[model samples]
Target: MSSRPAPPSPPRPISVAELDLDAPDGNVLSLRPAPGGPAVVAGDVYALVRLRGRPAATVIGTVAAGEDPAEVLGALARERLVAAGPRGDAERLAARSRPVSAGPPPRTSVVVATRERPEQLARALDSLLVQDHPDFEIVVVDNAPRTTGTRDLVTRKYADRVRYVREDTPGLAVAHNAGLAAADGPVLAFTDDDVIADPHWLTALTAPFTADPGLGCVTGLILPARLATPAQILLESHGGFAKGFAPRLYDPAEPPADEPLFPFTAGSFGSGANMAFRTEALRKAGGFDPATGTGTPAKGGDDLYAFVAVLSAGFRLRYTAEALVWHHHRDTWQDLRNQAYGYGAGLTAYLTATLVRSPRLLPALLTRLPRGLAYARAMTAQRGEPADGGVPGEHGTHHHPWPRSLSRLERRGMLYGPIGYAKARVTARRHGRNPR
Candidate 1:
């Protein structure tokens, strides 16, 4: 008969405050000692609560084993999720680790705002279906599709896990609102159907709320699925969608910046491809302004506007790199150019919105314009120079000057975004199109 190895020495026993999970469906979990298993019961979810109610030292999920609990907690903390585990000795740990009195957990919802792409959408749905967190439901809002494959894929492979919603509206933001209205989760995560989320994406994305009561939203890092194209490489080189940390609820009214920018910024920027928000927060923010996103000629910026509103409402925003997702970048030069122009247009919209509220930021635009032009000119001249023997390469410019210039102009344009948006608001009023 096969014998199992002796159980490892038990770490110092610690006490968990108690398992308390208030699920949204009127389910309540109370921690009660189980006869032969982990202490603490939460309906189907049982907690072993080892080492004095602390998580076992053993690591879980796709991360490497023997990983430091602190690092794991950091990953969770980055997402602003609840993280409570032992630190030093059992006694020392007890002083700091406190089990949170969790209110009813948010019924998280997933919305995939998709365009015409089907293959990528299939991959994204596959990832969503395989998520370890199962409390959530998904809505794939078809945004004026050129093909019907997205609907078909959902009906076939993900019939159990997904609900397909078709929004004839052509804009990405509009499609997202349709999904938001159709969803039931108190918290909502919106991802482009073109991206693949790591299995832990949902958990990490929702962790922040568990830690801080005030946290209203979470944004995760978006690594590229493939960085083969020159445009993709260039975009990454310039830190596309990769943002420095910023504090969201930081009342400039507050005394000092206590936290690093990663998770707590007013404009906690992240790719629309990988971001989550509380559903109540979305409702309060009025469900993504359609004028700012893809529905308009401007390709994107809805996420930024939503982030801004969440911060303005005095809620915290967090960025979790461990909650990773991969986005497929446009492969062709033409696609890249189109993306660049669309981004510029979107920034134009965002800038216009920002200017009306904070007029002082208006000067930042003028300062950036000269610097942007200088960089563009220098890059253009270098690309214009022949690769060898003064002969121009087959591709007229080794690095296309126009896209790069347009990218710079777009960034510069953001400095003016608020002013421009405000101007547009006034102009729209005269034209009978309500800008607000």
Candidate 2:
């Protein structure tokens, strides 16, 4: 039997809270639980500050045992949010009040891919069923199940509200592809089984498609569902999955000046946890690459591959912070270590998949290779003095340094990416599916 040493003791847990700056009263804000998280408590708190129901910023605050958490967090939120100035709040409210178009939002199919985590799946499904979207359907893709837990849950609990599909193949891409095959609506949105989506998520995600005929993909903001653990705090402190509050449209016709790598800088585009696609565009681009993503030797990259694929097909990608989902991050150091390896592996594997599947993009990738390499170094480098170079952190910028050990694991994953991808491709072939 093999013995693995346990990690050191973790830090004090920080409770996750949601602070709406636009609460009925000015400073009389009530700190609420993050979706799927516990109630507000006096200790360290990580809050998602929303101004007028829009995610304004995330700020950290502390409250003594005797002090009220809401009061403490409210003061911190007001002070920090004020720093954003009055114009910012006005614009956010304006944007919210502004309509996308005269017509209704597109009909949508939301895909929730899962495996053995029935509890998480159920929580995610409950959130999805309550979406404010005018028209939508939920499809639960049970990926490579070890038992019928997911099937039973969907059939018994969400029979009428949610549709259930199963993929015997284990890979995340394969599972998503299964959902992709079953998706009926013109617009398809994909979120993980561990998420608690905002009520307006589906509406916000699909609205762009109806408003912008040329847009192919839409991705949204992802905030930590829970920050009650050190690993989660560490990850969120480094940006977690939340992209900034700024809405961006990446039109291949004209790349942004800030991104020299353009479409290839897909990670910055958005994450898989909160992404949607124009059904026809994704189908035309060949759906997701089965050789990538979790559950495969590739560790990850399924989402990244699809992002690049859709973009390369000459369609634009939009990112709106308005469409949000709360994600439950891995809570332990080992999980973090695994994530680091997966992230690194998935990056390279997706890059490899992109080139192999769409050979023409190889030239563009080659031209940007040098700069990409430089960026990778900066990303895996230490924190600040060395940083992950990930999305800007809460309230803006990081609070903790990236660990050198995790960085090394990530680098090793990058090295194994191509090999792992190749292995996954072979596995797919043996299983009677097309990996390419």
Name the lDDT of candidate 2: 0.82
TM-score to true structure, per model: 0.61, 0.91
Q: Flag regions of model 1 displaced more than 4 Å.
A: 1-105, 244-268, 354-435
Tell me the whole-model lDDT of each prediction, alpha carbons only: 0.55, 0.82
Query: Tens digits of per-residue lDDT for model 1 on 1-436?
Result: 9998664332222211112222111122343432212432122121112223322121111223445333332333222212342333333433323333544345688899887777878888888888766588999998877787888888987787799999875666677778888998878898987677767678767766767767777887665454445565444434445442222233323413553331122333576887888878768756675555765544566777677666656676766554556566677667766666565556556545544443555675455556544653453333333221111122222242223454454555444445444554554355344534
True-vs-predicted CA distance for residue 213, candidate 2, Å: 0.5
Candidate 2 lDDT, tens digit per residue, 9-119? 454677777887653225534468887677787787777777667665667777888898878878876665454457566455445534456367788999989999999
On the 0 to 100 scale, the lDDT of residue 421 in model 1 is 49
Find the candidate with the highest TM-score and give its number.
Answer: 2
Count clashing residue pairs per candidate. Answer: 32, 3
